[model samples]
Structure formats: structure tokens, C-alpha cells
Target: MTVILVTGGNRGIGLAIVQAVGTRVADATVLVGCRSTANAEEPIKELKKLGVPAKLKALEITITDDASIRAAVKVVEENHGKLDVLINNAAAVTLPKSTDLTDVRESWARTLDCVATSQVLVTKAFLPLLRKAEWGRVVMNSSARGSIGRNIALELPPSPHWLYNCSKAALNLATIDFRNAEVRDIPDERDHITFWTVSPGHCKTGFNNFRGVKDPAEGAEVIARLLESKRGEISSATFWEFEEGKFQQVPW
Candidate 1:
């Protein structure tokens, strides 16, 4: 049976991905991560209806504490034994900045912890299980606003929403580093992990709460496609955009 670990899977794109993947991967073990599984009652019920093996793992976002990440990993291991796809999708970005840079630096650090650092930390905690799979996939749900080719090249004014921009930029770099690590650092010529930073585009969910381009179902479907890629057909360390069941190479 295939196993998947998805963060922020209680709502929006997360819920949509769970639902879509349920219909496709019949025997897949889906583990959804949330700050409190108690709040995830509604979605977990919906997943159970799909009649596939599904579990909820608790993960508090405010606590970037490594223990939280490990607890989540422990749940996945106990239930599924191994991890195949890890969707580092739990992300939080504040609304367009309304304050001075100095005042917002602290908040920026918090965003750094969740959006950037947590992605790396959570994956590291679960990587041991990922390596157990002959083919493992790690997808970092990222934003194009973090694109260095676009934003750093003066494409968008750096002053608009500095905090979110910086966080995503850090995430993109981290995704690249994860790809290189998974590919070149494995022992004895065994490397099966393919890492990517993918953009959900303007997904309309509580994260933005209907303030974006596509609905959560539409956006998460893209994530499903990437996760189910055929063996040996790899897309590692790249940034991908979903467009009508096809991919557009988003600038990094």
C-alpha cells in the first residue's frame, strides 16, 4: 500500500487533495496533519467516507518546536510504517504588510519559522521513512511570489509585502537544497527521492478565503497529479505550475 503525509490537510487545498487522492489511490494510506485533530473532525469524516485508510496527525503551527514535528512523524510511522510522499504544504503568510519593516521583523521571523523552517524540519524528521521507499516524492507547496527570477529581478516592487516574499524566497532555496541532498548524498548509489517546489497558484481557500484564482479542489488536483507521477519519470528540484492538466515551468 502507498503512504502519504500531507500537512494542513484539514481544509482548502489540503482537504481537496485528500478527496481527490482518495478516489485515485485505492489502497493509499493518507495521513493528514493539523495543529489539533479535534478541529479536523469534519474533514476526517469526509475522508472516512471514501473508504480508504486515512489518519489524522496533530501538529501545532505556533510551536515550531521539533517535538511537534517528531510527534507527527511518529503517528505516520505507527500507522503506515513508511512514508512515500510528503507534502510540505502547511504554509502561513500574513496579509499585505501595513506596517514598517522594523516593526514587522519579528512577525517575519515567525513566518520564517512556519513557512520556511518548518518545511525543512518536518521533512528531515520524516526523511528516514521516505528513504525506505524505492521511489519517494517530496513536494513543497510554494508561491510564485517567491521566485527569485521574477521578484529579485525587480519584476515586482520588493516593498509591497516584504515578509511573505522573503519567506517564499527562503522556501524555494530550501526546496532546491533538499533536492540536491536527496539526489547526491544518498549512500551506495541509491537515490529515489524527487523533490519539487510547486505553486498552487491563486487557490481560493480560507488561507485566502475565496480571494484567489482557482478553487481549492482545482488547485489541489495539481498536487495530486505530481504525487502520482510514474516511476523513473522524475521532476526534481524544479518549480512547477498546474495549467489544465499540463505543467508550465514557473520561473525560479
Candidate 2:
């Protein structure tokens, strides 16, 4: 069975991703990563009631805490021996309410730490277990608003959440860095691990107070498609999104 772990799987797009994998991916075991196992109970129950085929289990993981991160890795190592997929889906951002420089700085720092730095640290911690699998994949949950290309081309409107965008841009860069380090340079195909970044496209989640246009399930389709695709069918170090019933690459 493919051992898939999705951080922040307790709700919203993360939960939708778990459902997608549970129903769509064959012989899959999904680890729902959350701050507490108790936090995941309701969602797991709901998924089960909906008759999801894959095995679902709660995994306690607090991305901002080092001890929690280490503990999560240990648990997965003991239970699964190897992880086929790791989805870095958990992220937090506090929008600054004022134009004050100090407030902006603090918000920026915290957002970067929560969204980008912690994801890299978590991926690093699980690298050994990922390597133990036949084909390990890491998917970084990013946003289209983080695309520098779109920003430069005037494709997107100005937004107040600059810090969040900046953090996601850093995440995109980290995805490329991991791909270069693990897949590009490694001569042995068996040792190669793929890394990717995905934009879920403004899903209606608590993060945005339900202001987004798409449903969480709609936002999760790209990731499901990526995970289900053959290793050679998709390339690493790429950004992706699902729009208008199809998967497409997003500019960096």
C-alpha cells in the first residue's frame, strides 16, 4: 500500500485531499496529520461515513514545534517503515491590520516561519523514511498568488497578504531546491525522490473565511491527479493547478 501522509489534513483543502486519495488512489493508507489526534476524529468519522476506501488514521503533528515534528517522524517510522508520499499542506498566516513597519515585520517573520521554514524542516526530517520507499514524492502546497511570473505580467490583482505570497514564493523555491538536490544530481534512479509545488486556487476554507470561489474538493483535484499519475508522466520541480476540469502548470 502507498503510505501517504498529509499535514493539516484535519480540515479544508487538506481534508479534501485526504478524501480524494482515499477514494481515488488504489491500496492507499492515508495518515491525516494534525495538531492532535482528537482534532482529526470528527473529520475521520465523516470520511468513513462517506465510505472512503483507503485506511485513514490520525497523526499528531504540529509543524511549528520541533518536538512535535520529531515525534511525528518517529511514529511514522515505527508504524510504516517508509512513506510513499509527503504532502506539506499545513500553513498559517496572520495578516497585518495596520501599515506600521513593526507590525509588518512581525507578520512577515511569523508567516515565513510557519509556511516555508517549517515545511522544509519537516521534509528534511522525513527524508530517510521517504528514501526507503520505492518512489518517494513530496508535494508542497503553494498558491498561485505566489507566482512571481504572474505578478510580473500583471495577471493578478494587488493584495494585502504580501507576506503570505512571499512565503509561498519561498516554498516554490524550496521545492526546486529539493528536486535539484535529490532528483537531478542523483545518478542512481532508485535514490531519486520527486518534489512538486501545487496551487489549490482560492478554496473556500476557514483560512479565507469562505470568501474563495472554489470548493475545497475542487481545489484538491490537482494534487490527486499528480499523486495518481505515473512517475515518468510528470516531472519534478514544477508548479501545478487544476482549472476548468484539467491540470495545468503554473508559472513560478
**Which candidate wins on TM-score?**
2
Q: Rate the local accuracy (lDDT) of all candidates.
A: 0.75, 0.94
- Writing each residue's lDDT as its tens digit, candidate 1 over 212-251 gives 7787877876677777677656567888878676777778
For 87-112, candidate 2 gives per-residue lDDT tens digits of 99999997776879998888899899
Candidate 2, number of clashes? 0
Candidate that would win on lDDT: 2
Model 1 clashing-pair count:
1
Give the CA lDDT, 0 to 100, for residue 24 in model 1.
69
Q: List the residue pairs that clash in candidate 1.
A: 205-209
Compute each candidate's TM-score over C-alphas.
0.87, 0.97
Candidate 2: residue 97 Cα off by (Å): 4.9
**Residue runs of model 1 more than 4 Å from their true location after superposition:** 49-63, 95-102, 152-159, 187-190
lDDT at position 169, candidate 1: 85
Error of 1 at 160 (Å): 2.7
Candidate 1: worst-modelled 10 consecutive residues by lDDT = 54-63
Q: What is the C-alpha RMSD of each candidate to the true structure, in Å?
A: 2.9, 1.1
